[model samples]
Every structure is written in structure tokens, then in C-alpha cells.
Target: MLVLITYDVNTEDAAGRRRLRQIAKQCVNYGQRVQNSVFECLLDTAQCRSLQNKLCKLMDPERDSLRFYYLGKKYESKIEHFGCKQTYLPEDPMIL
Candidate 1:
């Protein structure tokens, strides 16, 4: 399944800044970042749950925000993009 994850972390203090980096690091391990704070992750049920748990632990509920959009297996047809940033399939091979 495709999971679209987006987050907003309050960066008003040093601790908040650190939390933002920690959250982004976790996302980088599981998905590609589409926007500064949005990631598109292709994960199974277990993987999704694990990531969610990790994020929940790191976030300050009163100061941060997170959202998960489940886009099933056929997510390609569900996404539409029109921008200068070239988009690629999450399942496609990425050469670093």
C-alpha cells in the first residue's frame, strides 16, 4: 500500500528543532520526501504501524501535527502532479 505521511513540527525552540530533524530522519528511512514535510511511503501493514508508533513517540502531541493517507495498492491513478519537480513512482528503482 501507499501511505502519504505529512507532519508539522513546532520549531520554536531548540528541542522542537531537534524533534523535527529526528522525525525527518525516520521518514527518510521509510520513504521519499515529496515536500519539505511530506513523505510518500510504500509499506505493508506491519511497516506502517511500526512507523506510526515511532513517529507518535517522537512527536509532541500538543505542538506537532501528523497525518497519514492510505492510498491502497493502486495509488498511481490516485495521484496527480503538475510542477517543476519531476515525480517518480515509489516502486521505481532509485539510483543514489
Candidate 2:
């Protein structure tokens, strides 16, 4: 299965970005840092869960925040429509 995970990290500190990078690397097959506080990633369900777990562990409860979107089949269609060669989509939700 293929998944597109887009995330927003709501913090401006260097530590916050570093922690997010660490967590992202753990689960993403590929990623692009959109800005200092946003990122887009491609992953599988297992990978997404692992990444989420890592993010939860790294974030400070009061100082850091994270939001994730699961793009699933729509992500694959977008990739193809944009000329990407990939042809699969995740079939499960990682948040469970």
C-alpha cells in the first residue's frame, strides 16, 4: 500500500524541526520539507504508524504540535495525474 502523509509542525524552534525530521525519517520512503514547519511524505500504513509514534514521543506536550493527513488512493491518483509512475495506495488507517 502507498500513503501520502502531509504534516504541519506548529513550532518555530530548531529543536522542534530537528525532532520532526527524526520522526519523519523513521517512516517516510521520501519526504520534502515544504517550509520550516511543514512537510510532505510518502509512506505505508506501518511506516505511518511508526512515524506517528516517534513524533508523539519527540514532541513536547505543551510546546510542539503535529497534524497529519492520510491521502490514500487520492494520493496515488494525484501522483499519476502529475506524471509520477507509482501505482498503489494504502488500504488501512494507521491511526487505529
Candidate 3:
């Protein structure tokens, strides 16, 4: 499945900033970043649950927001991109 993760963290304080970084780090481990606060991840149910748990722990519900868009196995036809950022296949090999 393709999971699109997006987050908004209140970076008005040091702690908030730290949380934001931690969240981004965790997201990076599971997928590729498509925008400053958006990520495109390809994960199975268990992996997605694990990552969701990790992210939930790293964010403060009162100060941060997180969203997950689940695009099932046939996600290719569901997404459309019209920006400068190149589109990528989540299932393809990532060199780095």
C-alpha cells in the first residue's frame, strides 16, 4: 500500500522543534519526503501500524497534527502531480 503522511507541528518552542525533527526522522526511515511536511511511504499493514505508533508517540496531540492517506495496492492511478518535484514510484528501488 502507499501511505501518504502529512504533519503540521507547532514550532513555536524548542520542544516543538525537537518533536518536529524527530517526527521527520521517523518518517524518513519509512518513506521518501515529497514536501517539507509530507511523505510518501509504501508499507504493509503491520509496518504502517508500527510507524503510526511511533509517530503518535513523538507528537503532542495538543500541538501537532498528523494525517495518513491510505492508497491501496492500486495507487498508481489515484495520484496526480503537477509540480516541479519529480514524481516517483514508491515501489521502485531507492539508491540512498
Candidate 4:
């Protein structure tokens, strides 16, 4: 199956980006990160769970912010149902 994962980091600091990248690398060949904080992962149930665990570990306690969304579907599904629903929004402008 293919899974779509989206994540939002609470801050724009270097630490946040570094943590995000570290978590993403865990997926290796099973996933491809399509956006800065979003990743399109292809995996089975076991792989998904492993990825989730790794993501939780990458979070910083001081930040108090970590969020992830996962969407999964069988390989035979239509293309229309796959991919991101919206374009990436800049973190700066959205704050105001």
C-alpha cells in the first residue's frame, strides 16, 4: 500500500527542520518526502508503525509541538485519490 504523511512543525527554527529531516530519513526507500514537512510513504502496516514510532522520538520536548497525518490506500486505487490535497503554504505568512 501507499501512505501519504503530512506533518507540521511548530517552529521555523533550525532545530525543527533538523528533527523533521531525521525522522524522514528513517523511512529510507519506503518513503519519499514531497514537501518540507510532508512525506508520501509507501509501506505496509508494520512499516507504518515503525515510522510512527521513529517520528515520535525525533520530537523535541521543549517545543511542545508535533503533529502528523497519514493517508493509506491499496496500490490499485485511482490516481485521483492519491497525492496532496493542497499546495504547501509558507509558514511565515500563515502565522499572521
Q: Which candidate would rank higher by lDDT, 1 or 2?
A: 1
Cα lDDT, all candidates: 0.98, 0.58, 0.96, 0.60
Ranking of candidates on TM-score, top first: 1, 3, 4, 2
TM-scores vs. true structure, each candidate: 0.98, 0.52, 0.97, 0.57
Output the lDDT of residue 83, model 3: 77
Model 2 pairs in collision? 2-90
Q: After superposition, how far is residue 21 of candidate 2 from its true place, in Å?
A: 6.4
By lDDT, the best candidate is 1
Clashing pairs in 3: none
lDDT of 4 by residue, 1-96 (tens): 566666555558888778767766764445665666556666778988877777778877667354544444643333344466553322224332
Q: Report the number of the highest-TM-score candidate.
A: 1
Per-residue C-alpha lDDT of model 1 across residues 1-96, encoded as one tens digit per residue: 999999999999999999999999999999999999999999999999999999999999999999999999999899999989999999999999
Flag regions of model 3 displaced more than 4 Å.
none
Q: Sort every candidate by lDDT, greatest first.
A: 1, 3, 4, 2
The positional error of residue 30 in candidate 4, measured at the CA in angstroms, is: 2.7
What's every prediction's RMSD, in angstroms? 0.5, 7.5, 0.7, 9.9
Per-residue accuracy of model 3 over 1-96 as CA lDDT, tens digit each = 999999999999999999999999999999999999999999999999999999999999999999999999999999999979888898888786
Please state the error at residue 34 of candidate 1 in Å: 0.6
Candidate 1 Cα misplacement greater than 4 A, ranges: none
Tens digits of per-residue lDDT for model 2 on 2-80?
4434444544888877766775665443455444444556666777787777778876767766677666645645544
Deviation in Å, model 2, residue 73 alpha carbon:
2.4
